[model samples]
Target chain A: MERETILSVRDLDVKFSLRGRKLNALRGVSLDLYKGESLAIVGESGSGKSVFVKTFMGLLDANGWIDGGSITYKGEDLTKYTTEKQWLGIRGKEIAMVLQDPMTSLNPLKTIGAQIIEAIELHQNLHGEAARKEMLSVLTDVGITEPERRAKQYPHEFSGGMRQRVVIAIAVACRPQVLICDEPTTALDVTIQAQILHLIRDLKEKYNLTTVYITHDLGVVANVADRIAVMYAGDIVEIGLCEEVFYEPKHPYTWALLSSLPQLGVKGEPLYSIHGTPPNLFYEVKGDAFAPRNPQALKIDFVKRPPYFDVSPTHKARTWLLDPRAPKIDPPEAVRKLATEGVKGYA
Target chain B: MPENENREVLLSVRDMSVCFGKGKRIFKAVNNVSFDIFKGETFGLVGESGSGKTTIGRAIIRINPTTSGDVIFKGQKINGKISKELDRRVTREIQMIFQDPMASLNERAKVDYIVSEGLYSGERISEEERKRRVEKALQEVGLLPEFASRFPHEFSGGQRQRIGVARALIMQPDFIIADEPISALDVSIRAQVLNLLSELQKERGLTYLFISHDLSVMRFICDRIAVIHKGVLVELAETEKLFAHPLHPYTRALLSAIPLPDPVREKNKVLEVYDPTQHDYSVDKPSWVEIEEGHMVWGNEKELNRYRDMLKA
Candidate 1:
């Protein structure tokens, strides 16, 4: 199926000034967000997955700035948005964000209904009873049992799962074309996490909104995401269809990430783990940033950076192992089984 | 796990209940829970937040007072008004590793002091011997010995968590109560900590009461697992047995809710929502029963009979 690109990012570089030192949070990252597709960016903390999406809504910190490249959406260069006034036009109506912690996301002072109405009035141009009506509908849309009574309650009265639903309601109230959920289910329980994921997918279909999920947990996004992007050291090491990334992963980092899952582990053996920490962004990264920690790193991986190699028409990875001249190396045993027998091998 | 008769029961909680507040505002966090953890095995307690899994762990470690029932560790009741010698023994033999390493450790104090804090309470040791023990603990948890001098703010999340483990291991505890130990860690880092814990268990023959909400990790590490909901244990069986035959509705619901790593299987999976109102317990009260050998479930007589037939089928 041919799909249209909703947003295109090219060689985007984001840097933060921390304690008088330049930190390269995002280093020459590029990707395309397709219309109405759910793309998941998987990485550990400080891997720049959050920073990458923060650029879309101009949500970068005061000390952080876009150093280079462009973010093109709806025939406009988003990187050129300098003022909050200019960004206000694209922030909520075009793109909305649901943050990780629902406890801090909502106002404890105000009622849940009033908060959703505020978003509707600010973005949807509705007011008074109409805005209130829209807020109630949004609450009902998010699976709240009693919309009328729940609207009158404060955030403290709701459970963690319920509070997350309110946060989603507020985001959905803006009626944005694209919705970004940053670790939406990390703070929630397993049963509630599954329900919230299902709610997000349903909301996406109902509104025809393109969705982006940013999480460190790969298991949480397997069922929800249509595509997967593996990020390491502020770079997109691999991007592919969900099945391709899980089954036929090429990057050693991707293999390590897949093999590190506890679900793929044997009872008596140690689970696969990355040995060292991520490279410090304050210093210049040489060649591949993940090479120092990657056990299967090729010799040249430390000298020169690898370019994106096409594994298929829809899948691409950045690794020296993909080069024809590189020696053959096998991924971990678990990852090999993922390729041969799919996720069933571990199951 | 070995046969029940052959293996020794390391810790047994009989009708344990933990309550909070008093009078009309009273709350029972754990209501009449009972289980036995065998020696040299990881006993898992799986439940959601507010399910009293953490509360049970706290009660075992004497952080929370139990209003009723008893906690017997090696054939001795170790709760409420114990003797001074027994108190000292309990303090030394049982240690807890708290969740959220970022908050568990003292930010102002150096790692050396935080780890040796327990040692000072029991027996007095020379400063040189304390330092040596600290170094050994750090090395066992895969941290550099030099890190003992640095404050917790200097370490990353995983490193700080390792410090927490070192602090617990330094006590040479026989049983460890780990409360959501790896939940605050990154995915790759969780593997490292889990491997360290299992290795330490093998070397020391430690029994662990592992309390967590993540079932996937529990399946990997736990020998026997118990499913708890709203302070009540609904099922208890070996890890594989519980997964294969979930007799309780809540257990089945939780199992169905776990997001599989496989996309195709996940997409095809059907979710089960458990409703408490499904059981007409107003007339027929519920009780814990061993429906099969070593497999327990909480249900009334009618529901227990139905479960037996389902298990057979």
Candidate 2:
């Protein structure tokens, strides 16, 4: 059965001009988010992952300008909406977001209850007692105990993990069709991080909402995402089912990302890290942005950017190495072992 | 374990405890934590926030006065009130690299000034000689020599960390406490910095108290592992042994929580939470006991009995 696409982004381009230098933050990036499924956008910082998703929530900085492309939500072009007033209706109601830092995202002055109730009241005509009731229930639903007491407490009173849970509660308050989480658990501890990941997954199921989870950790993507979108230098280099992407990654960059992750049970062997920093987005470039750092770069890779070559019906990667004419290069030995031993049952 | 041979005992933290405030209202930040770092070996301290890992590091360097116990480096005790002589010796022998490189370093200072600040207290050296030393330190950390002229903001996060390392190395300290040094770096750059630290430790014979929450990282660089939780050192063992057969409940839980790269195995592997009450330690005061050679576990008979009883349920 074909799933309904909740959000479809096409040829999306976001640019910034600083000190008379134009930088392309997102260059012709496109992907789809289906209802009731998670699409994880994975990449290192400065890979333009955040910038591409920020467009959905209308959270781009003042310097950022959408140069081209359209973001369609439920067949409506969100890019066409120019004002915050129009976006406010959808921002927290239809398309809610959970930012990286819960401390910064929440207002310290306001009580959690007040803030949550305010969120609920904005979309609904509930007032006073009724709004408070809804807010407490939402808090309880997100796994916070003693919802009444917790709702009255300020953001500072809660731990990093609890505050993030509160933020998730507020995001899910309106039953938004889409929830965008931007590195939601990056600052949290591993145990707390696992709980939060489970919470997000549970909430996604309960609400039957489409989720766009953006993070640098491939370990996170492997656990939570239904499909994976590998981004590099403001472009979607690869996109596939989670199993296919993890086990049979065709792109050298994806292979590098997979291999770079530190694994348990892999004793003594040094974890492989992708060499060289991500390229500066300021300069206009021909060929691939990843070619210079790619160990298996060919003459064609240097001359022009590779088109999206299909590996399977659902999996594709933008790499010259994917070309039928290009010579096939195997992944590093350690990575091969990691895929077979560590990543069993994925493919 | 091969690196354990020829390892000189550089720093030894014995029964160190640090308490904040006073009287009955006092909070024990570091409760009887103990470990040893041999010369030219990297000893990792792994724990989550509020685990008192940082307090242990600071106490060893005498940044914070220990409430009780001692931090012995070489043979001299380094804790409590610092005298002028002790301060000079401790500062010269030990250095620190903080988590946030940009915030730890002076933003306004040039790279050379930051690196040479430690040498300012030494006998007056020629400006040319100082510049040479600064450039040499930068080169050692894999940064370009010309970076000396640039400010902190000009460099990337990874470069700034290299600068921080260079600053510490310029002091030529025998032991260095790196508190989550690479936690702030990008995933791709983290390996570079780790490799750089590993190589520098080999070339310079520097001992490191490498502290981090990430177990995968700890496994790579550390020779021995110390697991702390809620102001107590729960487990200490050789890095490989600790990873292979983690005895303590917390250590086992910590090992289980490390996310594997493999998608399928990650789903199947259920990480058990660390329950401290499962071990017997109620008969005597809580302290680390040597279960085997170089391996320590916290709790005495009284607490251990309680834990054993709980496990029986």
Candidate 3:
């Protein structure tokens, strides 16, 4: 069956201006977010994973603007949305975002019930008793117990995990077709993180909502992602099915990321680390942005950017090594072990 | 298992307890926690938030006052009251690496001053000596000497964490208490910091007390792991033994919560939720028992016997 793309981004370019300097945060990025499928965007900090998704909902800062390209969602170009009024028509009713920190995202003074009710009344078009009923139902849906009593409590009265659940409740109250979770579990504990991931997955199944996860932790990505997109220096270096990306990765950056995990690492030995930092976005990037950090970079990689080469119908990578003339380089030992042994090697 | 008698006990916390407030609102942050950190070994203390893992780390560093019990370092008692010479020695020998790189560092101070801050407390050293030491420390952590002139705000999260490590390393301490050192770092950068820590340990024979909520990370780095819940330890065992045969229910739950980077296993995995109320310790009065060669568990007689059976199976 051919899957329908709910949101299609074609060659999107997002730029930010800081102190008279221009930063190419998202450079020629393209992605197709499928319906009811969870796509995880995995990258290091400053890799523009957040910037790429921010353009989807028109949430970029005042200093930032779309440089070029199109974000076509249901036949509408979101890049053309210049005013807050235009964005309001698409923001919560069409798409909603759960930000990284739950503490800062919520209002301290407002009751948790009032916040969810506000989102419910404004977006869902239900008011008074109906909105209040919906707020309680949403609270229960997020696994919060004693919804009636807890809803009246302030944000300071809740724990970190409970506050996150309230935040999730508010986001889901809008009944959006798509939900974007930007490092939702980064500030949470491991147990709480697992519960939240399960909750999100359950919510996705219940609502048939397309979910997009932005995280640096591959462990979290593996648990929830149906498909994975590896971003590097504001570019999608690799995109594939979760199994394909984990087992048969073709990009050096992906290999390094998988190899560096402590689960795959052998004790008393140094894990494969990507030396140096990510490339600065202020200067114009030539060729591959990851070329400087990549040890086995082909000469051509430094001169020109490699186009996406299809490995399989579902897998593609942007690297010169995938080209026909490039030399066949073996992946790191750890990544290769993962390919052959699967999870058992780590287990 | 090797004999622990011959091994040197670098720092030992005997029946230590830390309490906050008083008169109807007393809260025991660390309740009668006892453990010995051997020389040149990574001892992991794993727990969820509000479990007193940070409290224990603070108590050892003298940031928090211990309500009772002794914190013996080498041969002398370091906690509570001590001689001025002994206090100075303890300060010079023990150091700490904090969790959040962004919050731990002083925003206005240069890397040079931050790294050499410990040296400024004790003796009046020459400016050139302090500068040389700062450069050497930065170089040790794989940062360029020129980075010492820059402020903390100019660096990345990973770079800022390396500065934290450099600050701890400049003290030349025998022991370092790293409280969630890599929790705030990126995944790739975590590998860098972990490798750097192990490398430094091998080079200088430094002991570490690694505290974190993540069990998978503890599995990679720690020699022995202790599971604490609500300020009370439930289990202590070798890393492999803990993974192979987790006795306590809380330990099993914690291990089950670790998110593996394998989709097949992770998706099919069943989460074990721990309920502390399951333990009927009111009558039995649970006590710490060494169930195996080096493994320990906090349980009464009945629970201990069942744990033994679980190990056998």
The runs of at least 3 residues in candidate 3 whose Cα sits more than 4 Å from the true structure, single-residue gaps closed, are A343-347
Q: Pick the candidate with the highest lDDT.
A: 1
C-alpha-based local distance difference test score of model 3: 0.91
- Which candidate number would show the highest TM-score if scored against the true structure? 1
TM-score of each: 0.98, 0.94, 0.98
Cα lDDT tens digits, model 1, B1-313, are 5787789998999999999999999999999999999999999999999999999998988989999999999999998779999989999899999899999999899999999899999889999999999999999998999998899999999999899999999999999999999999989899999999999999999999999998889999999999999999999999989888888999999998888787777788888889988999888899999999899999998999999998999
Q: Cα deviation of A307 in candidate 2 (Å)? A: 1.0
Flag regions of model 1 displaced more than 4 Å.
A342-347
i-RMSD of model 2 (Å, 1 decimal): 4.5
DockQ of each: 0.65, 0.45, 0.66
Better of 1 and 2 by lDDT: 1
lDDT of each: 0.92, 0.84, 0.91
Model 1 per-residue lDDT at A20:
97
Residue B60, model 2: lDDT of 85
Q: Of the pair 1 and 2, which is ahead by DockQ?
A: 1
Tens digits of per-residue lDDT for model 3, B13-126: 988999999989999988888888889999999998899999999999899999999999997899998889988888889999999999999998988889999998888899
Model 2 chain B weakest 10-residue run by lDDT: B303-312
The lowest-lDDT stretch of 10 consecutive residues in candidate 3 chain A is: A338-347
